[model samples]
Target chain A: MALNRKVGFFKGLKYKGGGPMWAWILHRLSGLAMVFFVGSHIIAGFLTQQFGSDVGIAINIVYENWIFQLVLFFLVIFHAVNGLRVTLLDLWPALLEYQRESIWLEWLVIIPLYVLILFTVLKSALGL
Target chain B: MQKITLKLFRYNPETDTKPHYDTFELEAEPTDRVLDLMEKVKGYHDGSLSFRRSCAHGVCGSCAMRINGQNMLACKTLVQDLKTSRITVEPILGLSVLKDMIVDMDPFFDSYKKVMPFFVNDEPKPAQERHQSIEDRERFDDTTKCILCGACTTSCPSFWSNDEYIGPAAIVNAHRFIFDSRDKGAAERLQILNDQFGVYRCRTIFNCTVACPREIQITQAIGEVKKAIATGSLD
Candidate 1:
């Protein structure tokens, strides 16, 4: 009862949770990233209103950076696809046996779409 | 016989301030079970080595421990299965270790008890028996294989973060009764599992499914429980 010690994050990482564990971790990380992005976006909008066009332009520069855009796009796409995978499996328990395949399917869907996004972002960043 | 190095976790509440590993070089057949290696070390090398073993055949689930980074029944895992001469054995994670390779199972069992693991049917008894169809029997057959080894629960990251989560084993047990046609406690069990600390804590990580020595489809079972709670339909 009193002896319960929380497993350290790195120690828990050592335990082989396999593909699903990675998926769970990614899903959580992406979800958090999206929340932070939205919160910062709202704050940026407020700053733009109070601090004038200079602050708005500075914030736009960071947001418009291709590297940040690529990472943000990845977080959004992965979170959506993985959330769909988890939701689909939760809705249909019989599909649970194909969980590994579902994870594969999620990657299959994410890769092509992410690649296209990467190409578009890279072209714009390079002025190509 | 092949040369193997057995690394065991050592700890004593009375003496050692922290746990440490003790290594023993011993020769054993590749076919020998990990439990056999532990026995040899305890019987010959050091009598101070401590671990739990009962039945020595994986039936009682007493010998469940982390073998080569995976939760497995030592009696059921062979030396050859490890594909290496070096073996590292430790207690399953999440619960507090009472000694070396032996954790306090009371916390694990407390979660099990919270799920109402026993059959509860307040309906009047039938003349001979409460008849169940073969189809109905198969509904909960997978979850019935749980030996309460604490492998699945301890392997869960959710449980490692918070012991109050009730982990996956309790959800599996809840699924067993939730789907039972003969049991009238489905509604009660569903209500119990509907909490945030209940079924929702499971992140669909599949660690419980992998850690289960019985090869139960633990994640599928938990999914079923979640569905039952959401729909309020045991079907």
Candidate 2:
């Protein structure tokens, strides 16, 4: 198209905000968190294997911690299920018609799973 | 008469390096349309101000602009609808702005044209009128209301990022034909929309649906198109 002015670089991007946008943004953040967790995990594994007693104890401490286990569980579940949602979107673009309901459904499924994990971690943490 | 604040975007590409907002205090009734306020500004307040309007009603879709950060037909939005005395108006995004509130629409229209938005029939023309059932015509009735207003497309973030994506307006027009029972070009149109740069580019953000002046459910239509692409079924 003919132009009287170039589209504003900093300001032109303003658009209405909605569910899919937030879902995509959250997915990226969750992926980044997983990347960090995985990176530290690999390093811990390598250190534990080579350093023997000292690093092995440290790795076990973190591995057995209930708080650490809970967070790890939450992040993995969120990333995996949300990733599946993304895949469904890519393969069948029409799924967007139900995007709102799908998002609510994702929460419905994730929340019970979260609570179940919560109890499992508690049982192990307290040794009850 | 009550005084209302009109914060209009002002930019002159010829002279000004930085675009800024120009606020006009005017006498207006709470029921006056936003376009009415603008007309008053241009008619008596300052003749140098420029914006496009025809029909002075919502039918032409010429007065669409961003009011309070939402794209809507200026004629359709009432002063009281804003619920505030201060109003902020600017040109729609996803298109190059020419001046004050006018935007370069060639890119928008070109995307619509690329969809090949017309009926096609391979068989010889019927000597008599081609007949259609009410059900067949009802399938695409929602899309026929589109007036080529840039509201839906311009409000889309993907369209803002990539003008080549064949925004929602084009897709809506394509839906009008693709679902028409008498049209023989559904395959061709579907092929065009199935391209990586086509319908799949829509992120289903629903901004287009919200911004459409005709109240057309734009995202829903786009989803229907996507279903047709995936299942090989238009139902």
Highest TM-score model number? 1
Candidate 1 residues lying further than 4 Å off, grouped into runs, are A1-4, A52-60
- For model 2, the DockQ equals 0.30
Model 1, B1-235: lDDT tens digits are 9999999988888788888899999999999999999999999999988899989988899998988888999999999999999999988998888888888888888888998988899888888988899999999999989888889999999899888998888888888888888888888888888887999998888999988999999999999988888887777
Q: Interface RMSDs of all predictions?
A: 2.4, 4.1
Q: Per-residue lDDT of A26-87 in model 1, one digit per residue for the tens?
A: 88899998898787777778888887667766777787789989999999999999998988
Local distance difference test, per candidate?
0.89, 0.82
What DockQ values do the models have? 0.55, 0.30
Model 2's lDDT to the true fold? Answer: 0.82
Docking level of model 1: medium
TM-score: model 1 vs. ground truth: 0.92
Deviation of model 1 at B7, angstroms: 2.4
True contacts kept of each: 0.69, 0.29
